[model samples]
Target: MFILGISALYHDSAAALIKDGEIIAAAQEERFTRKKHDLSVPINAIAYCLKEAGIDVGQLDAVAFYDNPILTMERFLDNLVFAAKTDDTDDLMKFSYDSIFGTKLWIHKELEQALGGLGKLGKLLVAEHHISHAASAFYPSPFEDAAVITMDGVGEWATTTIGYGNKEDLKILRQINYPHSIGLLYSAFTYFCGFKVNSGDYKLMGLAPYGKPVYYDLIKERLINIKPDGSYRLNLEYFDYQYGRAMTNEKFAELFGGERRYPESAITKREMDMAASAQKVVEEVLILTAKTAKEITRSKNLVMAGGVALNCVANGKLLKEKIFDNIWIQPAAGDAGGALGCAFYAYYQYYGKKRVIGISDSQKGSYLGPAFSDEEIVKFLSQNEYPYEKFESAEMFYQKISALLQDEKVIGLCQGRMEYGPRALGNRSILGNPRSESMQSQINLKIKYRESFRPFAPSVLKETVLDYFELDGESPYMLFCANVQEHLRKEFSLDSLLDASNMDMLPVVNQARSEIPAVTHVDYSARIQTVDEERNPEYYRILRQLQKDTGYAVIINTSFNVRGEPIVCTPEDAYRCFMRTGMDVLVLNHMILYKEQQPEFVEWEDWRKSYELD
Candidate 1:
């Protein structure tokens, strides 16, 4: 049976296709639309999934939406009614009425329209938001039975859920509903710290290691009341999300001794402290939640999904605590992943299909998106009059690229299928030599055109993971941070360390903390992606070749796009990004292009204005 799953109308809208209980294709709408976190119905992504599946909409046996629109509308109504009691209801009521009566109430009609007149479409299924998240975590995981947890901003009424999945069935034992969300609590600080809420939460996470968590007590006392069992309630007086458009109210700013930081402003010690405090609270909640999940389910394994699960620092702490014998996180743990979860939920729970466990996972390394053939790439290159060269074989291609990387030359490596998650992985990555002291600054400033404080990730060979990082298992999705092995770290002078300020740490960040300086963060932790031959043989082979030449098995890896742009989707997109950036090499499958050999790119003004800053 063929099933199509969709998550839309919120950020990271996406579509997924499943055939006979196997995920065939999945992609976020942003990828095709070239809009960061595009929230429109995933029309282009759905088309891509159908094309990848070699089936039309008529071939689908079921269509599963990630959440129940009616339930979501009910929650919105509840919040609006509460707002009426405490605050001015004019604008809030108008927005809520328009949202529910205008759009949410007509989701089925919208789906029919999106599906191009749903005449041939089969059964339409709707799963609860958190249930969809739970299914996405447990179904694709290698565990037969595991404790499951999902946490995010308000999803219908539920913001967090704890459950257990056994074989083909799953059960939600408990939940924390909207207006008392850990996700929203963190996002509040994200907003106050000069970052966009849903998207900039990670930036807050990245900034945490720089400051002391002195405000943790203040947050616990004033903002949220977290319990020992991980259940919590927010002190609504300090937050405005329930009644107003803003996340935090005047009381919140007063408690924090300031107003919200304006976006793109200079970093301050207060922002850093708030970030660190928020991060500490988040980690504490996660750990408590995991412990409760283990206690209730008595499961040896744990599976996690939802946007909060994407916090690598918190995930690393969970791994270190070892509350469960094993843990598996959905690569696309955010709302985009809800598409996959809903589809699988319909397959196993709704259709009564048997679950089939895998040795690793059923996500195919999350490389379940479009891949262009060499012929198609060649046609585009020829049509565009772009200069390039084709390698003799895959072995020779990686060998040459590996040699180029050793020279500290940055390569825009676009090969195989695009990744289904926010992470770039090897399939859609810009790679550089991690050993170079200047590589990090160069890529961030010249190539990516992003904040200098953002750290790069390391893609290390699986066999040599322990040789470089303090991790022993797989991290295929770049979802965990492990310290560089003690032996591999370099000792820094006291003066160099003392000169690093809380507000401006670039001088200290530039100092090599480990053998691989480019990928190492200021705290010496590296967000790790361990590459195994079985999962990604081509990327692994390149790492092996680099190891053979440079005697190090790590490479700096970041998404293959400039700031605010989605990762390149096609050969044309790749070439345009290549010419726009200062990348030294462009590897499109077997074809390679050097920057010096290409003709001058003339559309700088228009191209620079194309992508809006996130």
Candidate 2:
């Protein structure tokens, strides 16, 4: 049986398709549309999945949506009544009920209309928001039984939920409702810090390292009330986010002793301190929640998804605590992963199929989207009359690219599989030599066009991760953190280290960490992707060749597109990005296109520029 899953109308819209309990295709709508976190119906994504699966929409046995609308509406009305009871009229935008319902309740009929109504499919299943989030977390986990935690801003009414998933069953134990969300708290700070709400939270996480957590006590004492069982309630008086909204209010500004930071303005000690404070609070709440989930379910293994699961720092702490023996996080842990969750939910929940014991069947393998054939790439290039050359073999391709990389040239590598998560990994990545301190600044300003302190990630060979990092297992999803090795620190250190005693205070410094420093964070920890030849053989072979030539088994790996645009999904998109950016080389399938060889411009009248130019 074939099953389709969808998450939309909220941020991070996406789609997933499953056949006989195995994930066949999955992708976020943003990747195809070039709209970052597009919150409309994922028509392009659904069409791509159908195309990938070699079927039409009519062939699907069942379709599942990630959230139930009625339940979500009920929560909206309740929150509105609660807001009025407090007489919160001054903070009209965020605390009003109409604003909240308008964003959530209005999407259902709109979605069905987008889906071509009931005539297109025989049955449509509407899964509860948190249930779908919980199912997405546990069902694909490689554990016979695992405690599941789903945390996001607000899903219908539930902001946080705890449950357990075993072979064929899932049981939700308890929930923390809306107006008391860890996500909203973090997002409030995200907005106050002058960043976009849903999209800017990661920026808040990145800004934490630059400041100290001075507001921790104040936040805990005034904003939220945490209980013993990991349940918490927000103090409605100090904030507003109920209706039409921006997160914080005048009271919040006063509490913080100032107004929100202006975007792209000076990055003061204040913003940094706020980031650190919010991050610390988020970490504490997550740990407390994880510990509570373990106690309630008594499950040794844990699986987590939802937007909160994207907080790698918090996830690292959870892993370090040893409360759970193992943890598996969905790479696309936000609403995008809900598509996969919905598809899997249809398989195990609706069809009553038995899950394979201890199997994570979402062949997602990090690379789950469309990959262009050499012929298709060649056709596009030739039709556009773009200058390019073809290599005889994979060895030749790697040998040439490796030489370009050693000279500190930025190379856009678009090869075999497309990644499913926010990270690009190697398949859809821009590569650079990481040893140069200037590389970070150059890529940030010249290419990424984003923040300076926001660090890059490294793609290390699976066998060589230990030589540079203190990690023991495969970090295929780039979720976990491992410190750098101690031995190699001396080689890269610019300052003098005369005494061994100095090392005591600098535990994370000068570790033989993955030979790539730009990608490594301030703590000498890296979110790593271990490349094994068996999984992505072609990409691994390229890395192996580069390693042989450079004596380093690592390369700076980041998403293929620039800051605001989504990762490139088509040859046209890839070529346009390559032309616009400062990249030195474009490796499209077997064809290699040098920047110098291409024409100054097509300047053709027929060129419509319909493809996303960014």
Best by TM-score: 1
Residue lDDT tens for model 2, 108-162: 4555566554224566787887778878777767788999999999888889999
Candidate 2 runs further than 4 Å off: 86-113, 117-121, 358-361, 490-515, 602-614
Please write out the lDDT profile of model 1 over residues 457-491, one tens digit for every residue: 99999989999899868899999998998887888
Candidates' C-alpha lDDT: 0.89, 0.78
Candidate 2 clashing pairs, residues 3+ apart or interchain: 93-244, 99-244, 485-511, 485-512, 489-510
- Per-residue lDDT, model 2, residue 396, is 83
What's the C-alpha lDDT at position 241 in model 2?
76
Alpha carbon lDDT at 104, candidate 1 = 63
Candidate 2 has its poorest 10 consecutive residues by lDDT at 503-512
Q: Distance from true position, residue 52, model 1, in Å?
A: 0.9
